[model samples]
Target: MDKKPNHRLAAHMKEAGASNKGLARRVCEVAARHGEQRGTTHVSVQRWLDGGGIQPQTAAFVAEALSDKLHRTITPTDLGFPGPVPVTPTAGVNYAKSLPEALSVLDGLARLRPEDDPPSELLLTEADVDHAALTWLVSRPDGLSNDSAGSRRVGMRDIAAIRTAAGYFMQLDFQFGGGHAHKAFRHYFREEVLPLLDASYSAKVGTALFGAATEISQLLAWTAYDSGNHTLADRYMMSTLRLTQVVDDRMMGARILANMSHQANYLRQASRAMRLARAAIEGGRAHSTPRGMALFAAHEARALSTVGDHTGAGRAMNEAERFFELADTGDDPEWLSYMDEAELVGEFCHCFRDLGKSREAVHFAERAVSLTDPKYARTLGFCRMVLAQSQLLNGELEAAVTTAGLAVEAGDALQSARFQRYVTDFQHAVSVHASNSTVQQFNEQVRDAMTQMDDE
Candidate 1:
């Protein structure tokens, strides 16, 4: 059967104020910047607008072009495509050999919409991660020569400003969750940081600039992941890893791998998670501080637990603890200063919970809650909810109700969808005991919190 032409593409074309020839020109330009050669013309665009399908690569480029023109995310699906669109391999996954190539991928991702990029394109496979890790393992630092001529000159002040902005965004993300600041951070990176990368700098200044930009890119990825935009998160993480490699920062690369491991586990890609975590350990063994090693091991433990490898998880958890005990806060990277005993205990809570050891889960959850700082509002809420789940599962209904109430209180101050899911999951768990007064009260509190979220 001949398929009908899609009207959505026409509508979006009109919305973007782009004619056939204009859209074709924009797509070719965008594709060329990403190192893809395209021979798209006005006729190709007209065929698309007339309800004929284009090649997957062209479809992706057209979507990017429209997204740029419209200043919002546009997806192939949004254009009424029949199925997942194929993406260029080098779009965000290429491990660039030079700083400029790395920066190009980062800039490309900042402008892309998550839905426009499919999971197959954005998410890393086990083999892909292994190759990346191996590349990092063998790669030497590039000669730090900044001899290129450019219009504007970058300096220490610009680097400091970027670092300061990143720190402020990090604080906001911790307090209110990533959903609150994800868009603003993306805008800041695209509008503020991208321009500086194009400016001239001394080799020393360029190295520092890359370092600062790498950290900010990592933060952007974390916020995007926490905000529930996994596809976007994957793109950002890959870009960050590329930048880390360009700067030859082994510790930062390990952290990025651990993050990829965590995200893989979150998406239920357990075997891939295990591979990535092990890669982090392998790549970081010689260079990382004790605290950094512990972070990587803890991530490995979580991945092991997810796949029901209780013994492996236990060993990894113990290893994480041993390393954490040796950690000196003053000796660690400033980026890793956040990982401590409390964070390790929180990982244990998750590990035990996944292993179905409710009592152990509750014990560590309580300890984590006590040791966690109050400033981490979202983490506190999530930890409390984990405690509540353990309490309920252990048949301590009253305590569960109390603990769940506290989680709701903490969550009320945040705007995170992931946190809301945590609350909602707890609510579902307690609904069987709805007739009890405490359960009833917890339910009411949850209702109130959700209503407040809606109002806000």
Candidate 2:
């Protein structure tokens, strides 16, 4: 580090209403969010003020934190860093190579729009996901920093507020589906969480803070998936995977891989889905509870079923059930709170339906519907739809139509693109029996529901 007095940085700090400590805190936070834990502190800030040089990447974070504070872009040259400014890409589509770079991509993603040509022009590819997963496995977490900075102390209260709101955001996703569920978390994460990152705290609190951020990112992925914006969801999930390296959260990381598998299955990339599911199972095995293991196994089963691997799918499903049977709710993570017997049964319903086991599909679908809580509005709607599909595929036209009507009415209160897709799929399946009066009535009901959902 060059030990020269940095008048440029000092001048900007004055303009940005930042004290040395405040700037240090922001740098620490910005680095962490991007994927590293840079140990910036008031002392470090004072040293920079004393003309000490920093790494180009660290300089970028300082510039960014100041830019955030001053509400304008600040370059490293402006801060006395004698290096060329990093040319940040227009979006976070590709995996970031460094924390400072990750910060740049995240900033761009937060403000991204259709007008952002480079990123908006780039569609998601399998290479993007494959690279992210491989990077996560190979990445090592940055060493924890005990040093602290910022204007105020950050503690558990701040973390709780973010986590609590995240919990609420998740419930909203479950009840109403993901159409708009991610918005609140986005606002809260940007407004509440980011500011704290700029504040001072122990590394322990920072880890907790980073964990909350990871959760928000993962939730955004799911909500994006729910909205049928699979591309955007992939980007967020890939980002989440990067962050897991920072937090050293193997269990959560594995869960996210399984979610990626779920999305892959939806997109009909069963090959990729199967790979992701196996990766999740392998990675999470050490740290995960039986419930966690069960969840991963269930996802594997679904992917297997999608690829026409009946025996493999059945074997995987059996493992899922076996692990589930050994699960103790007391040992489950908060994220796994939604994965009960009903949820597992729903997975079974889908797999059986895909595997041409209509009898088993209907059986589990009924079990899932019966076991599902009414407040789990979206799950109930999905289970009912699967049940209807199973009935239709089994040549029970009237029963299928009746079940479909129930599904439409049951899901009416929710807005989910996935459910809408399910409705469309069922409609197509029942088209052959269009002459039936019950099928006609169900089609009209579906049209009305679709219209209402679309209008909303």
Candidate 3:
């Protein structure tokens, strides 16, 4: 209990001409509209002003009743009803309506959103994702400024350093997986990248700064996705999209949308994944390069495959391949340097594997595994697992066991929770052969690999 009288409520009641009994009746009426019933009375109103207790839900109705009477929004706080526990806003989800708001939202992500327990409020919702993507599609680019008040001079060199750090982090993610280097990643982001948001820069430098921030922010989201923190990753991607809008980075904004598509598909929300992918394709059309379009199309194919749409998946995959073939023109962003031929085909491996096209799945998976550079432990790990799945589907149990063992070896060198999931998937697929000793050995290998990696 607050143990303090709510004097503000008395003043608002007079201004709204709400008598105690009349307001009590109105509160009951308001609650009924929302399918809630309340037994409020004039005596309850007096008790409330005398520091007596009230149900939180009933308190809301009282506020709403006054709002209706006064024809103005009336929150409980304005009526001196400050509850003991504060209500924290869900941070890092909104697609900011302006540049300054985006920066503030990003700041709150690290501050207001507690890392412990996560609670139910920290969970991601499909409605939030839909709103973000829709806003990005319709909202005009912001008129950004270089006249931030802090007066700390930001230069091209700082942006270059950030760009370099982003590249390094991407490399680390590709090599050691997302579980590695997050401490260093957040340290650099908080200490180095964030301060630049308020620093002064020339118009050109400001554009470059936001562009560099876009890459780093996307990396932040990607790492979270790989580490299996879907809620956190979704927020990071939302922030990235807002940054892209501020800078009018059509291609980059679309890339963030594609990342959302990938994450949605990963979480088995195939329909929403398809929606995000199409949104990316539509949003990126004006400025995206062949490589960028390839990625968006690949995500579409992935979603289609997951939904059992073989024809649609194949068509989208063809578009991805055609765009990728044209990607040698060098019009892609520095951030997309990773979506090479191998990565494009790796998308095919994922699509075909999901569609149960064993031959094609194996064909693309082996090529992707071989073509992926040795240092890309995560990608290699992914390709090997897909190959194992294809082999298992083709009834090549012995080869499947061998290739899955190889994937487990790669998983040993990676720290991704998603990699661990892939291992689990392969184990489940081969578990039907639980009576077989070789399959059992492979399952044991997977267990050992997961034990060695970051179990978070």
Best by TM-score: 2
**Tens digit per residue, CA lDDT, model 2, 1-456:** 124578898999999889977988999999988876676778778867876535555778999999999999999988887653233342456776655445444443444322222443344566776777777666687543444335457898888887888889899998998875766656665556555654667888888877877787788778878877666676667767777776678889899999999988988889889988988998889879999999999999999999889999999999999999999943776778899999999999999999989999999999999999988888998999999999877878788889879989978757678888888999888888789888889889988887887787
Instruction: Please give each candidate's TM-score.
Output: 0.76, 0.83, 0.78
- Per-residue lDDT tens digits of candidate 3, residues 116-225? 22444575677887898889998887755533433257899999999999989999989887767555676677557776765567889888999998888788778767
Instruction: Determine the C-alpha RMSD for candidate 1 after optimal superposition of all C-alphas.
Output: 11.0
Candidate lDDT (C-alpha), each: 0.79, 0.79, 0.80
* RMSD, one per candidate, in order: 11.0, 5.9, 13.0
Q: Could you give the candidate ranking by lDDT, starting with the highest?
A: 3, 1, 2
Candidate 3: the clashing residue pairs are none
Worst-scoring 10-residue span by lDDT in model 1: 82-91
Q: Which should have the higher lDDT, number 1 or number 3? A: 3
